[model samples]
Target: MSAHAMKMLNTLLPALVAVFSASTFAGEAQIELKEGAGRDTVMANCAMCHSIDYIQMNSLFMKRTDWQATVDKMVNVMGAPISQDDISVILDYLTTYYGVE
Candidate 1:
């Protein structure tokens, strides 16, 4: 209605959008997958078969070979259909970030 009101609405609108955007991406930030694996890769390849918690909870625990085996199992036993490269990426992330001693 008023010019001042319109200006305030414009300013507040952007702030509101920013707040929502930050909140939306906040869930993304919580993801701790390996650097190369990233959120999209994990979601595309892993989320269909398992929960993100399954990945997060194992972080910093499984050994490198164990992680490789797990990925292999997902492909061979669980029928995840992931490519060898993707498997490698996922294993690399898990081992580097969460591998056990």
Candidate 2:
């Protein structure tokens, strides 16, 4: 490689490594979900993109519609790849366990 490219890589590599290492460490910490029906579905689908702690964090204020919108955003905007069957299970789980109504 050229000296300029090597120098650029050397300068940026440490920052990149630090970012990735932090992510790995963050992922090692587990957020326990409530034990109930459809918990498995939430785990299988939601954890693919984000930490499950978000459910608990928002539980205080979230209602059924809020959970529905969040799931819709995940599937439509964020491309979560969840199936229709799993969507119903997840909505049921969230609304029943975490949401208010």
Candidate 3:
């Protein structure tokens, strides 16, 4: 190839690769929760803002009270658009599966 063509290829190829790879790294599949009571409720409500992975990860460190606080924050501070009724169901599921034993 010509010198000018080689120069353009070197510059543009890396830029194109980076633009595509960035999107791949940024987006990820949501982790599916195990089936149990209120699993559907959690999938519908909490996943609206963050991934199920967030709950799974925090479950390692948090207890029922921490999950309660997190859920409260999502609703009260972050405006999660969840209902009080659903809150109870979601809390139950989180505490049961993800909550500290």
Best by lDDT: 2
How should the candidates be ordered by lDDT, best one leading? 2, 3, 1
Residues forming the 10-long window of minimal summed lDDT in candidate 3 = 23-32
Off by over 4 Å in 3: 1-30
What's the TM-score of every candidate structure? Answer: 0.58, 0.75, 0.71
Candidate 2 C-alpha lDDT tens digits along 1-101: 99999999999999999999898768657668889999999999998898788899999999989999999999999989999999999999999999984
Error of 2 at 77 (Å): 0.7
For residues 1-101, what per-residue lDDT tens digits would candidate 1 score against the true structure? 99999999999999999998888668756765555544566668888876676777876567988778888888899889898777776766677666777
lDDT (C-alpha, whole model) for all candidates: 0.75, 0.92, 0.86
Between candidates 1 and 3, the one scoring higher on lDDT is 3
The sequence of per-residue lDDT tens digits that candidate 3 reaches over residues 1-101 is: 99999999999999999998787546545366879999999989977777677877788888889999998999889999999999999889989998886
Clashing pairs in model 3, backbone N/Cα/C closer than 3 A: none
Best by TM-score: 2
